[model samples]
Target: MTDKQRTDRGTREYRMGELAERAGITVRTLRFYRERGLIPPPRREGRIAWYDDHHLARLRTIAALLERGHTLSGIADLASAFDSGRDVGEVLGLGEPSEETPVRLTPEALSDYFEGETTAENLSAALDLGYLATDGDELVHISRRLLDVSSALVKEGVPLSAVLAAGREVRGHAEALASLFVELLRPHAAEGDLQRLRPLAKSVVDAELSLALDRRLRGS
Candidate 1:
């Protein structure tokens, strides 16, 4: 067994031929994708090249995208956007969401969530909105609630692009609301009290939004 076959952490590694076979592609095609920058460069141990599960996952994602009628150039752009997007830690910053559950997803699974709407532009927009962050080769949606809501909206014939635009708008309002609440409580409440009372703020917003939606519907 060559050093290239295994890593220090015991991760499975494959040589080019083995990886190509596992990915159901020819070595030549794999090299072509590499040359085109569709995939990241493989780890090299002197003359031997090592590919790991991340590389395999990427290859499978590329194949799936191709099956979905995505052009090679488009796939390259998506790959670039995915690679450059912020990671989970950066998105969360100092504190994790106290109430919202985070959901981790593979790239293919995320495509399944949004169906044919997982374009490079949409991916970049989601990243910008802080809805998605990369964790290694996987993606972490900041909130399972948001993920479910977005997926349901898409199922209801809302375009992902439009949903993302609405989310961007909502984010601004949400931040402003948060600031307002913090300002209102800061003089009277300690930091710990503010943290503990967050659900009260959420409740106020939820009730108000429901009433606002009712008013809008009645007006319409």
Candidate 2:
């Protein structure tokens, strides 16, 4: 807002500079995003334009999708699709469902994360395991936890191939555990209640795993 442009009674307004600062982007970049239709048109008061919290939220969402390996064109398409009230499942076209946050990385960045272990064969294996999806020049890891754990294991001298094989085994056990918990909940709980109580299964698993580790360390 210009110094002359005061708040219009009910709605809060911010100047371009203020909006740019809030979004952590330069004015030039903000303008570029606007031109690309990545952000909505701001309300204009004569020559000055004013932005609001909605603009800030859109900017943050864009940043998150970018971090998750969406190209600008793809983000634009998603934004348009979401704005049009399309189903999220349709917009993504994901092969497998996942609740974990995805991590996006370039080929070089992926190599760095895995300590130079992102070989062609390992990449193929990851794709086959549904642990990775390609988005233009980026690779998106289906689960951030899996990506971090795999990278850490590689750093600890585990071969990438072995880590991937372990991941496959863990996937089978994880699915069985999930099925067991769902079966336990199906007859006794409402869907909403089951969703709310989902963390209980994780707590049980964590406790049991800890005890199992203790027993193994004690050779019992």
- Kindly list the per-residue Cα lDDT of model 2 for residues 10-52, writing each as its tens digit: 5456788878888898999889889988888998868878887
- Predicted structure with the largest TM-score when compared to the true one: 1
Each model's lDDT: 0.91, 0.72
Residue 115 error, candidate 2, Å: 2.6
Q: Candidate 2 overall Cα lDDT vs. reference?
A: 0.72
Q: How accurate is candidate 1 locally (lDDT)?
A: 0.91
Residues 161-189, model 1: lDDT tens digits: 99999999999999999999999999999
Clashes of each: 0, 1
Q: Give candidate 1 regions above 4 Å deviation.
A: 1-4
